[model samples]
Target chain A: AQTVTQSQPEMSVQEAETVTLSCTYDTSESNYYLFWYKQPPSRQMILVIRQEAYKQQNATENRFSVNFQKAAKSFSLKISDSQLGDTAMYFCAFSRYDNYGQNFVFGPGTRLSVLP
Target chain B: GAGVSQSPRYKVAKRGQDVALRCDPISGHVSLFWYQQALGQGPEFLTYFQNEAQLDKSGLPSDRFFAERPEGSVSTLKIQRTQQEDSAVYLCASSRTRNSNQPQHFGDGTRLSIL
Candidate 1:
């Protein structure tokens, strides 16, 4: 079974600053996918960023990026130029190559607060 | 729809009551997934459907939980004999394919409260 771990329970960053949320996972599979999801107060789970284990280059989406270290089983999400709207609960997820179904195991989550 | 849409944004049910949450996946999507999000916690996988075939349900908490996608487009997650612990936000997501690399688009979710 694959397990994702988000060590930080809560993180605070000043607006316009940068913050990184750490995540580690336990998975034996070498080919898999990792993702970071953001859940706002409205409870909408939004895709923040994603990284493919086979890809050596990190994934970047606007202000969000991920530092994916496949050997270390670590996929960390970095938010730059944070805004107040960036405050949300962030989750790290893992999914192996799925031939049957698509089910990803998620971490406990890390609550991020962007202060203005 | 442009994206996944779930009905009954908020549902309040008395203990032991049965509730059904609806989800409309994006058109032409090949996979649908249901997840439960407890307060202050990450969303947990409940079940998954590849088109009209339910390929995985190992994550369902109990037998009382059931889900179906009769037409392969809309899905319904039914929870019977709901308990207080069943109170959580039910999220529906869909993806173009069942591949692990495909991103899953999510709905806002239906908040289920068991009193």
Candidate 2:
């Protein structure tokens, strides 16, 4: 079984600043996928960024990026130039590559507040 | 719909009543998933379907829960004799294919409240 952990329960960042949310996972599989999802008050889970375990280079999507250290089993999300819209609950998820069902194990989540 | 669509964005039911939540996945999507999100908690997997076949349902908490995607496009999650513990947001997600690498698109969850 794979388990994802988000040590930070809540975080706050000033608008226009940068913030990093930490995440770690335990999985025996060598190939997998890591994802960060954001859920606002609307309760719509939106994909922020994703990283492939096989890729050495981190994944970047505009202001959202990830620091994926496969050996350490760590995948952290970084939000640069954060805005008020970035204030939401963030979750880290894990999925094995070969599993067609694509069952994702998710972390508890970190509530982020972007202060002006 | 351009993305996954869930019906009854908010549902309120009395205890012991049965409720059904609907989910319409993106056109041509081969995989659909249901998750339960309790207050202040991450979403937990409930079931999975590939086309119209239910591939996995180990995450369902109890026999009181049932899900079906008979036509493979629209899915429904039914809960019997709902209890206060059953109050939570039900999220539906779908992927273009069954491949694990593909990112799943989610719908605005249906919030169920048992009174």
Candidate 3:
């Protein structure tokens, strides 16, 4: 079984600042994927970024990026120049390569607040 | 049309009642997934469908929960004899392919409240 773990329950960052959320997972599969999803008060889950297990280079999308360390099974999300709109519940998810599609295993989330 | 959509943004049901939630996947999408999210918790996988075929349903917590995608585009999740524990947001997502690299597009979940 694959399990994702997000250590932070709550995080706060000032507007224009940067913050990082830590995530770790346990999986024996060599081929997998990692993702960071953000859910606002509207309860809509939004994809932030994703990383492929085989790719040594980390993934970056606009102001969001991931620090993926495959050996340690660590995937952390970094938000640069945070804005109020970035405030949301961030989830870390892992998925194994499968024929039917990937089965996502998500960690408990981290509530982020950006103070202006 | 551009993104995944879910019907009945909010649903309130009495215990033992049956409830059905609908999801419309993005046009041309081939994969659809259902997840359950309790308050303050992350979404948990419930089922997966590929082109009207239910490929995976191992994540369903109980036999009372069932999901189907008859035409490969629109999907429904049905819960029979719902319990208080079934009170959670039902989320639907879709992707262009079943590959792990494809990012999924999510819909604003249907919040199920069981009384």
Candidate 4:
């Protein structure tokens, strides 16, 4: 079974500052995918960034980037120049394809508040 | 639709009542998934579908939960004799392929309340 862990339960960052949310997972598979998703108060889950285990280059999307360390099973999300819109509950996710099918798992989530 | 769409946005049902939630995946998506999101928690996988075929349903907590995608586009999740424990936000997601690397597009979700 695969599981994702988000160590930080809640975090706050001042507007225009930077913040990083840590995530780690337990998985034996070498080839997998990791993702960070944002769920606003409206409860719509939006994809923030994603990294493929086979790719060493980190994934970056505008102000959002991920530091993916495959060997360490750690994938963290960094938000630069954070804006108030970044306030949301962030979740770390993992998925891998196997014989039966693809299995997806999510971490507990970290509530982030971007202060003005 | 431009994105995955789910309805009704909010559903409130008394205990023991049956409920059915609908999802309209992106037109060409080959895979669809259903998840249950509890308050202050991450979404938990409930079932998976590859087109019209249900490939995995191991995440369904009990027999009362059932999901189907008859046309490989619109999917429905039905809960029979719902209990208070089943109250949560039901989410639907779709992907371009069966590959796990593809990022899934999600719907806003239907908030299910079993009183």
DockQ of each: 0.78, 0.83, 0.78, 0.63
In CAPRI terms, model 4 is classed as: medium
Worst 10 residues of 2 chain B by lDDT: B96-105
Q: Candidate 3 at residue B37, lDDT?
A: 95
Provide the TM-score of the second chain in candidate 1: 0.98
Question: Which candidate wins on TM-score?
Answer: 2
Alpha-carbon runs more than 4 Å astray in model 4: A98-101
Among all windows of 10 consecutive residues in model 4 chain B, the one with the lowest summed lDDT is B96-105
User: Cα lDDT for residue A12, model 3?
Assistant: 100
lDDT string, candidate 2, B1-115, tens digits: 8999999999999999999999999999999999999999999999999999999999999999999999999999999999999999999999999999889899999999999
lDDT of 4 at A103: 51
Worst 10 residues of 1 chain B by lDDT: B96-105
Which candidate model has the greater DockQ, 2 or 4? 2
Instruction: List model 4's recovered fraction of native interface contacts, to 2 decimals.
Output: 0.66
RMSD (CA, angstroms), candidate 4: 1.2
Candidate 3, residue A104: the lDDT equals 84
State the lDDT at B79 in candidate 4: 99
CAPRI accuracy category, model 2: high
Evaluated on CA atoms against the true complex, candidate 3 attains a DockQ of 0.78
TM-score of each: 0.97, 0.98, 0.98, 0.97
- Please state the Cα-based DockQ of model 4 relative to the true two-chain complex: 0.63
lDDT of 4 by residue, A1-116 (tens): 89999999999999999999999999988888899999999888899998888899999999999998888899999999999999999999998854334757999999999999
lDDT of 3 by residue, A46-85 (tens): 9999998999999999999999999999999999999999
